[model samples]
Target: MTQAAAYSAARRKLHWGWITPPVLFAAIIAGATIGETRIPVATVLQVLGNNLLGTDYAVGRIDAGIVWDYRVSRAVVAACCGAGLALSGVVLQALLRNALADPYLLGISAGASTGAVAVTVAGVGAGVISLSVGAFAGATLSFLLVAALARAAGGGMGVRGAGVIVLAGIAGSQLFNALTAFVIAKSANAEQARGIMFWLMGNLSGVRWDDVWLAVPAAALGLGACLWHVRSLDAFTFGAGSAASLGVPVRRVQIVLIGLAALVTAAMVSMVGSIGFVGLVVPHAMRFVVGVRHARLVPASALAGAVFLIVSDILSRVLVPGQVLPIGVITALVGAPAFALILVRGRAR
Candidate 1:
């Protein structure tokens, strides 16, 4: 290639890299400002400035509270959840060497749901542990169980291992989902069951700052861990033997990255229920733009996922005026079709 042409390509790549972060930030701000009450973008910024920068601003108390306390928090949580789930999806797909692997597909979300339902509906460990804690515990346990089953089934870093893991995940998801149903059916009254069902469908309606605090750091840690092992992930693409020969400590890296993915999935699922598609679709969609390298794919998928979910959350709120639709329903409506398309495109390739 000519030097000028190469330079232009480099410039384009640099431009995209620089522009994505700001664009995602703008999307989050837009999401925060464009909710039911319709806070202006400027007002949202001013409210955030007042709190974060100690800047004097004259936004109304209600508007300020709505922006700072509720809308912004919800937007942040949505971004965190989206990024975390997308990162998890990328890691799982890379680690397992499978395009179809995702946190939900691996039963983590169902496990977290079972845990949350046990606390919220069945009143198990309610006083001793919060709902989020219970959900994380459930998710961790589910992941452990799946890991054990997969290992026992001779699952490792290849197609055979990927198949075993998928099968185990399907089994685990079904088992936990049934347990969740049973808990709700036996323990919850009619009204409580209705509310539990809505939560299970993934409502982010009443998100507060606490939710944001919980989700954001967990996502950050998970993403950081994934990025730290990007080189190993790339090596694993060839095969476990190749990766091991390259000094990647293949088994340890797999366990750590998968664990991180599961942890992030649990954190998000505990807060938002099992909102699907962000993890599965975002990584696949970003791959077309950022290429297959985990180093680029991880961050690109994270940002794209955040933008997608924030937009989805906005649509969920505005689609029915005052009524809020469960975010999971919107994701499923979008993800199922996108997943089909990915499969078709994969087949074509």
Candidate 2:
């Protein structure tokens, strides 16, 4: 390719890379904020402008009640949670050097669930912060154990060496799940048991603004780390041998990136109870749209992930006559088919 043409093409990709995320983020935020008393587009904008200006005046006020309670909080939680999980997935895919790698493919979700269940069942823990802390701890510890075992099993340190750890995570996750069930069942407080159940199903019913801060730093950190390492991630695409020959420090980068992804996953799962597929499905889909460059892919995945979850949460909130389906259900619905397609396509290739 000619230098000028290549330069122009690269510039175009860069521009779209930045533009797509905020656009997708904005649309999802607006759509999810629209519920029964659907706010007109113009009104939503006015409220947005007023808030950005730190004013009491809103752009448009529809039904004051819906705006105050259900829609706004739900939209915020969905955006944060979606971005967190999606970014985690992108980093993880690079770490594993596997197109199929997902955020929860490690035992993080299971361990996080165990920690969250303990908090809900025990009833003496600090609300969301305590739960987030416990979950992150559990997730990190589980991955550490699995990765350590994989290193030993592989006779070296690298993604291949860590492959066995994936299996270990699966086993560990099953044990954690069983333990979570037992812990909740034995809580012995009826209200605590009910809370535990609701948490397990995953709902945004009571999501407060406060619960969001826990995820923000983790998501930003993980995505930032991945973006910084985009070249290294791309090098690994050709396989570990190629990456190492290219000075990728394949093992060290793998460890750091995977760790970051795990932290992001732990943070989100703790708050939202394991929303699925944004990580697995969104990144792969974005790959088709934007190509395999991690720089573009990471942000695109973040944006797509946000849009996917916000819409899914909207569906979960409004799907039934009088009840909301857990957000996890909608994600699972979208993710399962997409995941199956990825697997099938991989086989075809």
Which candidate ranks first by TM-score, i.e. highest? Answer: 1
Candidate 1: stretches off by over 4 Å: 1-17, 151-160
lDDT of each: 0.86, 0.72
Tens-place lDDT per residue, model 2, 1-349, is 5999679758866886678767865765575355544666655554655556666653334443455445665677777778778887777776666565675666677777887667756554656557777787777876776666666677243556456756766677777778888887777477777766666666777776676676567767876787788889888777778899998898898888877777777778777786667787888888878888877787778777877888887787677756778888888888899879877886797
* Runs in model 2 lying further than 4 Å from the true structure: 1-13, 54-65, 123-129, 149-163
Residues 1-349 of candidate 1 have per-residue lDDT tens digits of: 6999678756755865798779877987998788777888899899989999999999899999888888888888999999999999998888778877898888889999999889877789848888878888888888888889999988876678788999999999899999999999999999989888888888888789878889889988987898788889899888889899999997799888887887788788888888887889999988877788777787788888888888999989888988899999899888899989988987898
State the lDDT at 110 in candidate 2: 74
RMSD after CA superposition, every candidate:
3.2, 3.4
True-structure lDDT of candidate 2: 0.72
RMSD of 2: 3.4
